[model samples]
Target: MKSLMKTALAAAVFITASNAVDLKVLITDTLKNNQNLKADRYYQEAKQKSFQSVRNIYNPKLTGGLNYNRLDLDVRNTQVVNTAAAFVKFSMDLYDGGKNRALKNQKLYEYKAQKYQNISNVNQTILNVVTLYFNLKTIKENIEVYKEKGRALKAQYERIKSKYDLKMATQEDVLKLKSEYEANLYTIEELKYQKMQLIKNIELYSGVKVSRLDTSVIPDTNVKYSTTSDIKALEENLKASEESINIAKSSKKPQLKIEDTLSYYRYSDYNEKLLSDLPDKQNQLNISLTFNIFDTSTKSKVESSKYIKLATASRLEFAKKQAKTDFELARQKLLTQKEKIKSLQSAVDMANSVYNTVKIKYENGLVDNITYLDALSKKIYYIALYKQAQNELQIIKMEYYLKSGIDYKKLLSLLK
Candidate 1:
């Protein structure tokens, strides 16, 4: 007996601990460990580095290498010569017709676009976590409702079976109650299976095992709107496209460059003696400007970039309109769920009253087993509906917040 009691105590403690988990904490952990988010962050960093790489055009580039050459003369009195040279070259682009500046801006805007895209991905991950968490919560509550109904049916079945043995109740009555009780148990099992599936899904998103979910509290339904990452990302893309036009135009202008080279040369004859008359060390500098006199490709590239910018601008406008539409729809859903929850609560109450009345009439032999069973079924159906509406209200509220561009953490704080 002591061992059994200890086991029960431990099981209760475990359940309580699991139920104590906060949804916000799970979301935080998920955001921290999500592989997709990590990949996006790395990609954003790479874009940032790419932008930095092209930001400075005046920086000088230095390179050094060694070269070896051997010449064999076929003519008379011509000796074989071997030459080895070590050379260092320094080069700088004095001007690129604003090409490098435009390139830098393009990279910078591309990085910004990626940065906002990462933010959007984070929001999506949070929504996934929240959705799964609430789904588990709803399933858990439904399981409890089924368990309660199962217990009530179990007692009613036992009572009917006793009455049948005494010939006071018909065999059909006993069989019907037994069937209902068994069905209730099956439903509970099915719900438990669904709960298990939901838990696994939560783990898939959060990278943490979920034994239970804490959703006794619901988030506030108040919604607010602000700029969303999706729109920001598109705006950056449009800016980058505008910069591409400048980059293309720069290609049509003059490009100037400066280069200097210092070299040490070693000359040797067939006998390997140094040729003293030949110059050994030399320095050379060159400054040149070049222009693409007339290029059909430059005009085509400029036109393509302008078209890209126009396309992006159209997409951005569509995104803004879509966001507005979604937000309004989410608000409508939230309000509908609120009304449904209120109506279902009243329905559950009425159904429970009707069930109590029918149950009393059946116990007194005033009503048939079918009526009693029907009332019980109606009561549980209403209860399930009420619970489902309550859960859906929370989900709708989250949807509303998401459309409003409110951060999930802020929404979590609003949860009572």
Candidate 2:
């Protein structure tokens, strides 16, 4: 009987209806159309550009400008002089004590960290869509079960009423049927409310209307995992913090810079002849080396950077521990849910068998109406529990994948 119940429930829950929406397709659409994910993409692009912007800090800079000057001299001969010049300047950092290198590496690490963070967010969004989708499925199924029970109770109540009218049934039996029917109706109403809430949540995450879901995909429960995105992000942050320490220490070393300027000058005829000693075209190359001679803050800055690196290292370790803990917890939960479903499945089958027997006995006047009603109620209750456990087990499977850093959508794709 338990095996028969399992087969029947599996057929009922796993069979895909013609009009049902595929979860894999829904998740894909949600990822494409979700507004929050779009914003995250934009932010990640901005971070990538920032990393690119700092990559060429060692490249030379060239600039050109025009200048004009007018001078009046009344000291000796009251001479008036006018000059115009066009100059091009080229400058490059010959050496920066590895500051540019460290800065560039820091930006690269920051970009990588942000990229992993975005991946983490994507994982979360997929989980949200899947969870809501499954929750709606469970609530809808439960509502239908309650409605079926309600219909059955209503029919029973009407039959008892007819018997009462014929003076073949007691008033107590009729009243019990009516009361049970009303309670069944109240349960249906409550389940409908839960279904409505689940629908709204599903729409919020998937950005689509809720309807029938295709529950054909059954993911494997054997958990497989890699380093999670959260851990990767934290590792990148640690690297960035180390680079910051490098950048801070670089300030204590000497820096060398080189510059070259070329100028073409034009002057008034009188001034040109009077200042013939200066050439019409001039070129100059300059090199300078400088260091922080007496700054008290450099040591403090480096020490601060070191502390930050230590903090980031600590965070990375904590994240690793937390990820492991979460995965183990999810695994335990999945195991427990499986056991619960096993137990409830047998209970549902037994309750159903008892209800069928008691229903026949009651109709033949061999059993009390109270015994029949209790059997009916127990059957429905066990069926609801069994169905809910099955749906929740699916959620646990997905969460197991999430904790292991396995992509749940890819698992869904295996349904094909």
* Candidate 2 residue spans exceeding 4 A from truth: 1-18, 57-59, 70-83, 170-175, 266-273, 276-279, 365-369, 407-412
Per-residue CA lDDT of candidate 2, range 1-416, in tens? Answer: 99999999877766546557788778888888788989988988998898887798675889999998776663222343667899999999988888889999999999899888988998888778877877778888888898889888888888889999999999999999888888878888888898889887777767887677776445675656679999999999999999998898888899999999999987663443455566688999999999888889989999999999999999899999999999999989988998999999899989989999999998889999889888998998999888888888877777788899875556666654
- Which stretch of 10 consecutive residues in model 2 shows the poorest summed lDDT? 72-81
TM-score of every candidate: 0.90, 0.87
In candidate 1, what are the lDDT values of residues 46-125, reduced to their tens digit? 99999999989665799999999877674213443777999999999888988888899899999999998888888888
